[model samples]
Target chain A: MSVELISRDNGIVAVITGEIDHHAAAQIRTEIDFALERQTPSLLIFDMSGVTFMDSSGIGLILGRQRITESYGGAVAVKNPSPCARRIITLAGLSTLIIEGKKENKNEAR
Target chain B: MKHDNYFKITLPALSRNESFARAAVSAFAAQLDPTVDKIGDIKAAVSEAVTNCIVHAYADSPVVGVVEITAKIKDDTLYIKIRDKGCGIDDIKQAMTPLFTSKPEEERAGLGFAVMESCCDKLKVTSTPGKGTTVTLTVRLDKKELA
Candidate 1:
């Protein structure tokens, strides 16, 4: 998997791509965590549009990040998840954690 | 008792091979002409089973264990069995409970068995401590209805 970090004034957007099974979760987690540590944005937006596949491991990755970011007084948001990815996330009872990105207001952080 | 087609593969219980196992099983199920959603379901279920082996089965040992996967197709049904020779579960009942993970520190949701049970038509798990664990999943293909 590949994670591209976009730094904005409001928060950091992580655009992740490729399959996110157990094989790729560790690397993706490390990359995202490194970016989070460096940026320390108020909000972390995960652009999952490019993600083709995800499983429970992906859930764990998100939860892990949420815990870390929340500990530092930040929030996590998932944007534009695929149908399959959405299913897994919802089944894991994480639907409330996702926030749709605003298309009209690109500068908005939350 | 009979299958028109069958395939078997044995791979080391490594986290890196989880995707490989999922892809192999999905490709094998493709012959049954299942829908994309059905295939996704199968992939999700297989991934959970394999992840369980990699995480829980070999939790203690430095030496990696072996995971065996078998697929069989009969008529419009697909059967998959994932077996692991590692530290087996002491309690199958508690293990199958949703949100019951032994490794909570790893951020495991403990929904592995729940996901597999929801995705497949039938799910069966059998394990013996100091022996091994086998998870059998059966899914009915919707090809006939779609055809």
Candidate 2:
């Protein structure tokens, strides 16, 4: 998985690529947390346009980040999650946390 | 009735292998000519089952544990079984409960079984505390219309 942090005037946008599974959650959490710490942006946007698949572990990663951001008076938002990923996030009761961003038409085949 | 096709694989209960298991099962299910949504559902169910084995089943082991996955197609239904020989669950009911993870520190959402249940037609879990745990998932493939 690859996470690229872009500094915006409002907040930081993290563009994440690849699958978010148990194996990739730790690294993702660490990277995003580091970015959050350094940037300390009021908002953290996760761009999941390149993400192919995600499971419950992805929920844990997001919740963990949410805890960190909330502690510092910052908020988290998810952007452009694939249909499959969106379903998992919704099932975990986290769809409300997602801020609808760019919509992608990619089919989740994997 | 006997299965028309069957596949089995044994892998170490490691976090990295979770994706491999999911991919393997999804590839096998492709024979049913399912849609992308159906394939996604199968992958999601398999991922949850395998993740449970890696996280909960082998929670405290210095050595790597083994997880066995078996997929079979019978008629229009696909059957998947994931077995782990590590630390078995004490209470199957409690374990299957939504948001009932033993390791809260790990940030576990505890929605593994719930996701599996939602994605598949049937989910059956059987375990013995000292023995092992087996999760069987049954998914029905809808007949595709000819173009």
Candidate 3:
């Protein structure tokens, strides 16, 4: 997976792409966690627009980020996740933690 | 719905191993005409279970272990078995607790069993200390059973 970290005025935005399976989890986790710690933003938004497949590793990464951000009294949210990604997040009871944007005609394969 | 077809696969116990197993089972189960969501859930849950085995069960063991996965279709239900001959859980109750993990440094969410329970119709886990652990997962494939 590829992760792009954009530092906004208020928070850090992480744009993740590719599959979030076991192979991708290790590197993505380290990169995202490093960014979160270094930036220490009040809000962390995960742009999962490019994620095609996500298993439990993705869920763990989200929850871990939430825990880390919450320690700093910050908030975390996700934007524009694919249908399959949304379903997995919902099943993990993370819909409340992350705000999803309105669905668009993108990443329909997922 | 009355007959059962079975297949078994054994791979090295490693972190990236689960994805291959999930892909194999998903492709096999699709031949049974299960709903897309059902297939996805099964694939996800199976991946979590198998990954857990590779991560926790075989954490420090130098000796190689096998991760066994079996998929069978019987009576319109899909049965999946994942076995790992690694460090067996001493307390199954504590192991099943959500958010309880032995290794937080690994960022183990401890949601493996919870996800499996939420997705499959039935999930049974049997473990023997120092022996091994086996997880049996079953999901019905009825058209009306899926969202």
Q: Given candidate 2, what's the lDDT at residue B62?
A: 86
Per-model TM-score (chain A alone): 0.88, 0.87, 0.85
Stretches of candidate 2 off by over 4 Å are A102-110, B1-3
Docking class of 3: medium
**lDDT per residue, candidate 2, A58-86, as tens digits?**
88888888888899899898997878788
On the 0 to 100 scale, the lDDT of residue A2 in model 3 is: 87
Give one digit per residue, the lDDT tens place, for model 1 in A1-110.
Answer: 88877778768888888888877888888888898888888888888877788888888888889998998899998898878888888998999977776432335434
Question: Which docking band does candidate 1 fall into?
Answer: medium
Q: Write the per-residue lDDT of candidate 1 for residues B1-147, one digit (tens) a residue.
A: 744999999999999899899999999999988888899999999999999999999888789899999999988899999999889999999999987989878878788998898899999999999888999999999764632
Interface RMSD of each: 1.1, 0.8, 1.7
What lDDT would candidate 3 get against the real structure?
0.82
Task: Report the C-alpha lDDT of model 3 over A1-110, residue by residue, as the tens digit.
Answer: 68877776778777888778766788887887898878788998888888877776788888788899999899889888877678778877788766666533323322
Clashes of 3: 0
lDDT for A97 in candidate 2 is 75
Angstrom error of the Cα, residue B12, model 2: value is 0.8
Worst 10 residues of 2 chain B by lDDT: B1-10
TM-scores across all candidates?
Answer: 0.93, 0.93, 0.86
Kindly report which residue pairs in candidate 3 clash with one another: none
User: Candidate 2 docking category?
Assistant: medium
